[model samples]
Target chain A: MDELLRPLVPQVLGVLVRRGADLATAEDAVQDALVEAVRRWPDGFPEDPKGWLVTVAWRKLVDAHRSEASRRTREVRVLHDVAQGPVEQRDDTLQLLFWCCHPALTSASAVALTLRAVGGLTTRQIAEAYLVPEATMAQRISRAKRTVSEHGVGADGDLGAVLRVLYLVFNEGYTGEVDLAAEAIRLTRLLARLSPEPEVGGLLALMLLHHARRPARRDADGMLVPLGRQDRSLWGTSLIAEGVDVLQTALAQDRLGEYQAQAAIAALHCDARSADETDWPQVLEWYDELLRINPSPVVALNRAVAVGEVDGARAGLAALASVPDDVPRRAAVAAWLHERAGEPATAAELYAHAASSAANLAERHHLLREAARLAPDAPGT
Target chain B: MAKFLLLKHYRGGPQQRPNARTPMEEWTPAEIAAHLRFMEDMADDLRRRGEWVGGEALAPEGAFVRYDGEGRPPVTDGPFAETKDLIAGWMMIDVESLERAHETAAYLSSAPGPGGRPLEEWIEVRPFLEYTPPVVD
Candidate 1:
């Protein structure tokens, strides 16, 4: 609930971990300290919240360790000395993020731990966002922390993994109690600031550019409005401008990554006044750059769509041949291509088939409608 | 109160509705979005009525496995071979009466399909064998 508190979580955690606190123990103490803050901080603000959290969490860590290991006067003396003195909080947020997103953990586990330690989201909030039971999420986080503690992602953890985890968070969308997309943007903004990596800026730009269209992404009844149909008037100009600015800055660095390339495509879409007015040639070019950076079936599938717009529907259909049928939504893309190619009958059949295997109700219904539109009785429901 | 499982099938159902005989793929993107919204709206409505239990849409791919032996491992087969049934997904609901359950199933079956027309797909409703509350001591 408190925006400021969540960011400080990883900052203070970095301090505790730096002082030789066990990763799991330090995380637990940090969480406890956060709980204490929620109850007491409203009464009166601490002179320095980060410092307060660090001190409290350190004390908890010391207590836990004291209970586990016999009190060596030497260790206790060292702990007491550190506790008594002024606590200094440094920006260990980036390092903590890298460690939390340890390569040893599965992406799901990495996401859970990162949201807790680096993103400062409560376990309950994270669980709610993921649509999993709180206890299940707790197990996931703790297990991830265990894996992290064992593997020990030494100084300067994997940046790629960190970015990937952040990307996954952003893509999880506005689900349940957490606006994970917003939270992702916030974290990426911090990473961009702390690390100064072009990819970090690229990621932030990509998020902002996509998020800028949030208002027009849905219709009055909360139905998803596809990009082509979305009202460009409802798009957030400020966010788009900020995203473009960030993207340009990143591009100027002379380093092109998937995020930057992807952001460029998003930027092109944002630049359009109308769907028909979109610069398809530029979009297709960017898709080429994206393919060069990250050549996957998903990218190939998307590139096929861009090909349709730039090279004509027939060419798009030809390009579609390269994408494996097993890839999700391949049939849908084929149906759209056929529709564009003026084969309404073929498109309708394809749409009907795709609907049967549609991933969700929305997709299924939409495909069904497309079939009906092209069927012999076009007017019938 | 009783609980019922409402099953949706991808390949097999009790005779398909003529209009919805078409698959979901042919629907326009807007139609798909509208159809999904309809399902979610139904869920939300059920929740408001205190009849919602749980629901999920399954991915298209699946396999049926039969346990073999400890060392041999399990044998696996496609979700359907000769068997025409290929379950797509399902919804579970708790209702005040069997009639309510049927009504809920009917409501789900009425979700908009192609041409903004009601799907009118037949829902196979089966009540839960046990109704034990999952409360722990």
Candidate 2:
């Protein structure tokens, strides 16, 4: 029942807001309607669930307004106005998304709010996912709602912020009860349906491509398996095909963005039968386009790695020189390039250095193993 | 997000060298000030990034206490004279992942030491046992 109703939350709230309901009150009313649904749906499903929710939530909003002495005058006016307005056939989820990702709220608050309002997640559920106290999550949600209300639902909502929030949720991975990545994909799919923006399609493709590789990303013991070392048999072929299809459609539009560029690179990786068979030149080309679009040091580091595969290690090292020194994984990148260039001693030293600097235990362990493998007289070798 | 405690010890940790060492008291005032400032800046940066939960510096003094017996007066001991390990402080953070916690610890370990060099100290990164149950299936 929850799975069926969750997708309708944003649309229902959007309808109420469009009918002159304040965001906070409208959200509360919708939540009440959801609770009522959970109680009543066991007997039978409604033929028009969306309509039922809207009517019930609207009545709840009006009842609360009428009960308040200060809101009595405004209640009659609002009721009359809502009665006169035509039933909105338009999809308001896009507008609700814009409101949820308002610039006034911090990214954390925005993420929390988006999960609550758009994703239809309870505060306890979000709190559990984030490993924070329920009270803290509740406070964050309320504060975000207040901030959005204060901003007054501006016409020009930043799509970038909405995309960013979704991306953030997707990257948060599946630690909590909810599969945030799946939730993110579901939300983005909805957004893509409502908004015909190519970037939305691009983001969806990127997420699908990355998510397809997730099964092969870690070992049974939860240790990370680097892309080159992952068991190819574990990769999701169907997801890869879907992602490629999505990326191709988005690319056909010719309005390229960062996500599309990234998805292109991922698709190239997916196309390869083995690490050695990877189309390094094509991957490097996508990275170049990504740099032109985003120009981040992280992208530059990745480009340097791709350069090592396309050109020689020496060329890759030269490219790495342009990336800032303080960037993470510099030593690991240097080690990989040096090993490929047949400089074993330097590569071993760099691997050790990278191990010390590595933040993730799995990565650190991997680097340490690499260093030990390259040692002059490794034990048991 | 997961919570982690970045523990700083006054002495006796995994990386504490038995012979080659200089205590903070032996450092020059400028070096000490630089190290302190670096720590402060790290906390500030964590706060700005919305990762910081709380942090505090512990005094060098402490005590051990135990119950003498049921319904009896408690027994107390003064701070140990030759304690090998002493907790200096701790910074609690709520970060996106264990990787991020490790990154923050590494950054904090880079605090300046004698001669304006990185201390390269060993910081213990301990995960908080969450009270909330896992939401995942």
Using lDDT as the measure, which candidate wins? 2
Q: Please, what are the lDDT tens digits per residue for candidate 2 over residues A1-381? A: 879999889889988887878898888889888999989988988888888888888878887787765546866566756855545777888888999999887778889989989999888888777866676677678777987888777788899999999998887677768888889999998988887788998999888888888888877876567789878889889989998998888899999999899889989998898988999999999999999999999899999999999889999999999988789789999998999999988999999999888755667777888898888898764
The C-alpha stretches of model 1 lying farther than 4 A from their native spots are A69-77, B1-137
Query: Which candidate leads in TM-score?
Result: 2
Best by DockQ: 2
Native contact fraction per model:
0.00, 0.00
What lDDT, from 0 to 1, does candidate 2 have?
0.84
Off by over 4 Å in 2: A63-87, A359-362, A372-380, B1-81, B84-137
Please provide, for model 1 over B1-137, each residue's C-alpha lDDT reduced to its tens digit, 9 standing for 90 to 100.
Answer: 45689998887767888856888998888888989999999887766444566789998788889989888978998866566887788998756577988988888888888888999988889876432211100
Question: Over the stretch A1-381, how does candidate 1's per-residue lDDT look in tens digits?
Answer: 378898788878888777777779999999999999999999999988888898888878787778877656578667767676565647888888888888898777788898999888898998777654566568778877888888877776899999999988887776567788889899999899898889999999999999899888767875556788889999999999999999999999999999999899999999999999999999999989988888999899999999999989999999999999988778888999998998988998999998787645556666787788899778752
Interface RMSD of structure candidate 1 (Å): 16.7
